[model samples]
Target: MTLPHVHIIGTGLLGTSLGLALRRAEYPVTLSDQSPTAVRLAADMGAGTAAEPSTADIVVVATPPDVAARTIVAALDTWPEATVTDVASVKTAVLAEARTLTGDPVLARYIGCHPMAGREKSGAIAARDDLFLARPWVVCSDEDTPADRLAAVVALAEATGAAVVHLDPEFHDSAVARVSHAPQVLASLMAGRLKDMPADGVALAGQGLRDVTRIAASDPGLWTQILAGNAAEVRAVLADVRADLDALIGALDLEPGALATIAGLFAAGNEGHDRIPGKHGQAPARYSSVTVFIDDTPGALARLFTDVGELGVNVEDIRIDHATGIKLGSVDISVIPSAQVTLTEGLAARGWWVPEAAIDTEGRE
Candidate 1:
């Protein structure tokens, strides 16, 4: 089969990653960006040739949400027969604007897509070919879209090792508002609270703080475009969050029924968290956590993983928490209940520190 040549516009993270993945998949890829240096960097990283394809079979608009519609329209006009798709996180607004800019015939050649994969970091420097692996690549196609065009876009998405999900533009926007967009807003807000804190106060942070604020270091200009583009849906989700925040504040004021309200909120949060899918989009499964203290040095993590691997225990998850006052890191290894005992015992026998609670005991878990 002749692999379709994919011409990617915008040599940022997504575009470069897609180019790398397509090139790895034996699909001819051409890359371009407004910044010459950016496209050159992507090309240097073996993503694609730093040039435009004369005849593109597929044109990917991997620009920001604000400019994505214009880019999509331009791609449709540039390559009349090429299937054009955008990887903008927001779908509805981009699709709406693209439809407004061009006629139905040209617009039918364009499809709005969102690859539910990205790191907090941006740019080609952070691009990874395997970034889309195991991530959901949402395709917002309508009845009016051509079958061949849809297939081409889907094939492009699959080439990046992403699982394709078909969703309408409106639903994709609302769904992302709840899952991704709102969470980013919340993380930024919570991280901002630390800006005014004293050095000592900030130094006392733990793993929980790190987890919440990890993405807070993202590029403000890029996120501004995303949040602005999906204002309505994001605002709706934030308004609901605001109501919950108001309730929490009221409870903190020691009003009547305050305890019940506080308890209900936490309980509801737990229930909601429990509903989240497990790895590979499977149903949630409970796991036991085993905490191990290690010296803050290189090879410590690798040694721990090697130990676990030697024990033949399957680890479900891992979290590292640096000790505040000491040069030590606490590693929390989560595994199924069945493997918890085996892992803990194996580590303990290997002279690794095992917390009393994590160790196998006849009386308790």
Candidate 2:
């Protein structure tokens, strides 16, 4: 198949990454941005060349939520022959705006899309060609949207190695409000509590706290725009979360049945957490961890990995716990339940200290 000539506007992370991914797939890609420096940087990074007057087969508007509708309309106007799509997180507002801005003919060529992939960092510099690999790319379409235009949008997502999912614009907006927007708000809120803490209290931070606050470091300006654009849906999700928060607070007051409410809340959290798919969209598999003591010297991890590779044991995940005031650390290697015995025996035979009962057969600790 002859790949589409893709024209990407907005040289931020998603735009630049899309350009690079399309270019890597042997498609002709052209990039443009309101910021000349951004376009230049993305072009220099091999994302794509500077935009020129040419017929684009597909026009991708990767602008922020606030400007997505306008950019999509402008792209459709400029490239009348091309199928247009936007990578805006919020879709309902943009789709509604596009419906009002253009007649049925022009609107038929446009599809609203949101690629569920990103980093805490922003800008063209942080863009990666493989950003969309194995990620969910939601495509919002309507009755007025043409079949070929929808196919073109799906092709763009699939060409970049994303898994495409079809959704209505309203559902797309509501779904992201629950999954993406709510998480960002919660992460930021949790991180904010640490702002006034003592240094010692902050120093005690562990992996759990780090995991919770990681997305909190994202660009506030971008999030502010997203939250504002999806205010209605996001507010709905936040209201529910606030109610849960109130319940938890009330539980802490030790009123009658409060303890049971707290327990129910925790149980609900576990159930929800377990529902999240494991690696590669598969059912969550339980992995067993095998902890081994290793020196803190260089090549220690490499040696362990090499040994495991030789044993044909695939490590699912790993964590290192540095021993305080010591040169040795504990390495916890998580593997599928079936590999637990083989890995434990092999490491012990290789003269590695495998502590008895070191395998955490129960789910993640």
Clashes of 1: 0
**Would you estimate the TM-scores of all the predictions?**
0.91, 0.94
> Best candidate per TM-score, number?
2
User: Candidate 2, which segments miss by more than 4 Å at Cα?
Assistant: 358-362
- Model 2's alpha-carbon lDDT is 0.88
lDDT of 2 by residue, 117-139 (tens): 99978899999999999999999
Error of 1 at 191 (Å): 1.8
Instruction: Give lDDT: candidate 2, residue 43.
Output: 98
Q: Write the per-residue lDDT of candidate 1 for residues 88-131, one digit (tens) a residue.
A: 99988887788789899888788889999998788999999999
After aligning candidate 2 to the native by TM-score, how far in Å is the CA of 12 from where it should be? 1.5
